[model samples]
Target: MARRPRLEPRETRLDATQAYLGRAADLAAEFAAGIPPRRIRTFSEAAPDDLRTALAILSEIPDLGLVVHGPRGCAVRAPGVAPLAVTDLDQRDTVLGSGEVLAETVRALDAAYAVTAIAVLGSPVIAINSDDIRATVATLGLELDKPVVWVRTEGFRSAVPATGGDAAADALLQLVDAEETEREPGLLNLLTSTRGPELAALARQIEGLGWQVNILPAGASVADIARAGRAEASLVLAPDLLDLFAEGLETRFGVTRLDVALPLGAQATTAVLRRVAALGGAAAPPAPPRSVSKPLAGRRIALALPTSWGLATAELIGDLGGDVAALSVPHLDRSHAAALASLAERWPDLQIHVGEGQGFERTGFLRRNALDLLLGASDAVAGALRQGLPAAVLDPARLIGAGAAEAVTAAVDSAFARLALARSAAQNARPGYTPGWLKRSPDWHIKQEVR
Candidate 1:
């Protein structure tokens, strides 16, 4: 029972559960209580796994070796996910202890590559199996003379897949030199959860505010992550998985945490810009007056994305005069109080379907509702096309900073411009579900979880 790094589960720490089946008001109402009542889907399909998330985040840090201490299944098939060395724990290792497997992988990674640091990723199997690897990890760190962190990411630990981001943050905290807590003047942490291509323009906009930006965990090296403690403040962006991350920085290093709402549209982006500029004692340059145009006028749109992305994108749609008919998000938590309130106030009748990857519900929405566009990169978007709904696939990369509104508007225009393809797709569409199932309510399978 050696001392392990601080790796608190987002479920226990934030009371952020991914299990909810409700609308905007239903979910927004739950915020009245400290912990929202848990809801479960009667039927479920694809969902986010914490392990996959942790692996993705960790692997993104260049030259950081990772070992997945789980079975081969969870370790492999992480398409475009990792350069991981999995323990591949067998029945024998599960019973006899798999520390050696982890140790061997760590040694192999260290011996072969010039990695800045090494991390051991946990999994559901290892969580259930309860094989301790703390002592081994600490010994490896000392043995290799590099940062070796244990990212506690069990797939089933939390309903919100973003909880894996929290785990990765917790593990990454070990890299920050706690001994050097002196604040670096004008250094800002542009904390985000997007794996989209490099965000040079976004960083430039922040740098225009007179602060050097440290874009973390995404396209960041081990050194960039290491110097995070000294940043003057942190500005968290969309994909709102940085609650624990920013909190940890503030708590540990006394960095200012500007936990603002996701900047998905023009107005919200300006607000974020103004906030960041004001922090660096620099005035945001005056711009021409915003001209509001309703490109999506008379159009009804539905979205299936992460909570922050859903709320912010929904707001962006509203800003552009598009009618947001429905929204499907992964999970809802207290951190979404402001965004939820804003959405509820603006579109009181906005229907909200909460779940990560429930294709049936998404398909049902297509069968029942008349939507001009469906916003998501999920298979449901294809279903929408087959059902004659124009869909603008969401890219988390473009949904930030000054160009967010422009990017979305362009995407919407492109989607609608190809309306003929969508109509043809619907006309020639093969049957996916039975007519009876189509007639039933999309959430007919959803039932309130009785306590």
Candidate 2:
């Protein structure tokens, strides 16, 4: 009797499980043991600590209301976003658990809005008091028709800010049905932040290839999320924030996720569209044509962005004939090792600053190096400008497609032309830190931690 042919093992892509948070230097170092341990200033408005990150994620979900299960201060609102109902636990309520307050708030929010889902978020006060968020949500769910999700977002628990977003995504995934359905051949679930002009352009690109794009959580309704299992596959626009949600979708409904770099530059955008088109069994459309009025040749740029975005931005800068002189990443993890390696190969001598609020270090670096431009978040851009350097805030929206590429080129040219004006303003403006103090070792404030 002939033995049955050996079954081939199916290839599995690296999902969010293998990810881990660490200092940027440790991540970039060839040997982790050889690297010096240091605690850099690790806070920024872009992140604003982990609690804010969780709140921000929940706020983006359309028609989903939030209940901050803590004191009035914990009920911090994200500007122009979702409505939040706070428990407003006081000293008396803290002594005797705020369960009643939570219950009342949930009921009030349920009556106030026609929300499809309600997220009950735990703040530091409630977390410390050991408030039973799960129990409260379960009890409330019995009376309410809408699904209630408990998001654990205690500020001190998570070291990496993105974990807060992960928790929010996990809670959102609870709303998705477990049972699989007939897959929609030309439907793609775009796991991203929200609907914007950039996202619209990306949707159009996919639509051009005969595929329909579903923006999750952002503009997605409860019905859309419930039927997410039917999509052909999920594509992560901002993997750092949405990879966990994508992984959850795949696990629950057999939906595959295309884990690729964001569609920032020409190469990355083309690669994204090609992979998406292939996944949906649609014909890949011709790459959009780009015309650069002024190429970034011989220009040196420094970037301050998250790892994934920074890597893609570096590639875009390179494609436009500019050099990524230095970059600052919020946190580095194992999940980014492959991309980091690729970047290292391209720029062997790239300078990487780890953590945030390193204005002193950034100022010193800009003054020391012959940098042409600084591209980063608002704070970083302002810091660069105050140092008499040409700078532009790195807008994620301006990194989508050919039109985005042109926009970036135009922004760079504009910043370069305004260098003299920026320098004059810097001379007149009151300095935040003295040049002498900034001249100290870039790691002057960083304390080494031996683990």
Candidate 3:
């Protein structure tokens, strides 16, 4: 008997078992309708990478109005962008979580920065129990009569710098907007699971709904998140941060959330836009052809990132107008299982290549297939480009909506377009290839290229 050739999904169809439950479907529907998007920012220990990322993000703030806490070492040099005051946490308090020290730091920071809100970063010895440390900050915020949020994240080694900005951005949303922001009349928060450049496009889609967007740490301020209370609603674009934010925000502010897979393809983007419009109590806009759901008769693509990005990336590609070529996630942990299962069920014929630390085989597979587009680690992308394939890096900072989606979409489209224009340029120059050390395993690969 002859074996059947691989079959890619027609568009995207999950088995009955994969369909969302009542509430899940309802929320997903609402998200497609249109809801208010929240603003976010991060607070955590000041690791080197964290500091660098913080500086990179903070520097972009026209007026650096952030309030920081920690020791003198807590402050990193933000070139050309400055003008914010940072409180030094000092040596003793660094290892030891001290209310007194934090109180003092908050007082100084509040007095100096007198800015919108405050968020904490991890530092020194306090890294231990950093998860619970936000409560301490809450107490301080209440005392200082300040709006402050604390972010807790593990430091990324130079070998693989984690997506600190994305994580930090997640925390920022929790800190500032969790309390004050009332859902706007009609808008949605584009919560992304994987941080990458494509965020810009997603944000633009939300804006198309006619609601205000506050992109937390990346494009929002303390004042913006505080305004969430007035927004129409919120939407979750990314899965990882979805549950965490959805549950917390729903309980705290009675804000409803529409949790859906990341909208990557034309179909998915259109569906997402419809959901956003519905939630806004308006007719869904005439979605552009480039939107995920349209014009994707049948195309194939590859998903090559850490395990963290596999499911989300696949969803995006399938939604747009493509099929999976290869799947390369860093590990085969539980997080990967759900994502893999989702894609596998949806696209039974597609090859879901799981890369468990064996970079050579995975790289070689991508090189050979040279799928339509590569979405994963920089190295894997480079491998594809080496074979004269088209590739684009994922950047989370670009995801923080704030009406940046059009530019982001243009960038993604242009990047892919350029691959055709300068196939030789990327191949010979190898400009897109990121070293293994720089690539964040799974979750952070999209933005590592920017680092």
Candidate 4:
């Protein structure tokens, strides 16, 4: 009754190596030989933990209540986070056990809210306390007559926040029961972690090709999830976050998992479409040639992005006549092997920095490079701006499908146009690190871990 899929962090499960600094060719070569290089940071600035990552995915399911079993402080991330009912484990609860509190919270949430399923999420406190979440959830599911699941996630399990996505994927898989369902004709599951205008556009693009699109694990109902196994194939946009779910679908329900490159650049969009359309005996129309403005003409740029976005958007950068000087990724694993190999075959000498939110390393890397611009998600971009590097916000949502070139160019052009602001900030803004530290090599604090 308590059968739960093992939800280990990416470090252990995926063998994601921490390459604090490396070159494209060397990393690709090592990985090609089935060797994953691991590194350790003597000093880490910051990294998003697994707990939040699980929350972000679980909350996206329609009418699913997340019971974040932790102290009041853990639930405080709820402001920007989704609506989660906290166990509110006080000192007494923590000292004795929070199992009762978690059960009570689940019951209360079920009573107060309209949730088809309630997930008892673990926290650092509960993880440390060794609470039996599966038993508690199993019991609640019977008592309440609802789909109750345990999402085993801890606050400190992984620095690679995306590992939490794996935890959520395993939990979500339990809710799916498509073994008996009749397979729908040409039904393609458009799996995504995004639910924005871009997602709608992507769905339409696929739908226009005469396939029934069923978006799941994000803005999908429990009934929709239950029928996910009835689909012909599951097409995942970003492998880093959604691949695990697709793999689960394949394993559990025999749903075909199409491991296509993310449709970021125009070429990728065409490739993704052709691959997916082929499943239904249909041919994808070729993408029209984009009018490249070359906004970043002859500019050398550094991008700090996730594996999927970094690999895809790097093509967009090149399409805009920009040279990708360096790629700063959050983590690296076998999932990145093919793309890393491709990048190596092209930009053999390109610098590759793999770590989570090490601003000190970024400061040194930026200082030592002759990059004209820096682009990344908000946090990394903010760090670059503070250090007086010309940086821009690289919203991954806006960079999907055929608009990748335009979206990237707009951001890069804006960063260049705001050159005065960057210079002004360079003179007035605080460096946030000691000059001595900045002077040292970015990988100075990185020591190879002895396996």
Cα-based TM-score, every candidate? 0.92, 0.86, 0.55, 0.94
User: Residue by residue across 98-132, what tens digits does model 1's lDDT show?
Assistant: 77778988899788788889989888877656767
Question: Best candidate, TM-score-wise?
Answer: 4
Q: Would you list the clashing residue pairs of candidate 1?
A: none
lDDT of each residue in 1-451, candidate 3, tens digit only: 2332221110111110111111122222333344312111121112234444445554444333443455565566655333445556555555565656555665676666546566665543355424344666678767877656554433331211233444344455455444444445554454433335567666666776676665533355455555554555566654332344554456666666665544544445667778777777657867555544333235456655534446565565565555665665432323234555566567755554432334444554555454566655566666566656666665433433332234334445655785764478554674332566324332222121211
> Which residue pairs clash within candidate 4?
none
Ranking, TM-score, top scorer first:
4, 1, 2, 3
lDDT of 2 by residue, 105-163 (tens): 99998899888888888877865577778887887887896688778675365546667
On the 0 to 100 scale, the lDDT of residue 428 in model 4 is: 88
User: What is the alpha-carbon RMSD of candidate 1 to the true structure?
Assistant: 2.5
Clashes of each: 0, 0, 87, 0
Best by lDDT: 4
Model 1: residues >4 Å from true position, as ranges? 1-8, 77-82, 195-198, 427-431, 435-440
lDDT for each candidate structure? 0.76, 0.71, 0.48, 0.79
| Candidate 4 backbone overlaps, count | 0
lDDT of 4 by residue, 172-260 (tens): 88788745667888889887776778778878888877889999777788778778888889998767877888998898788899877
Off by more than 4 A, model 4: 2-5, 78-82, 287-295
lDDT of 3: 0.48
Better of 1 and 2 by lDDT: 1
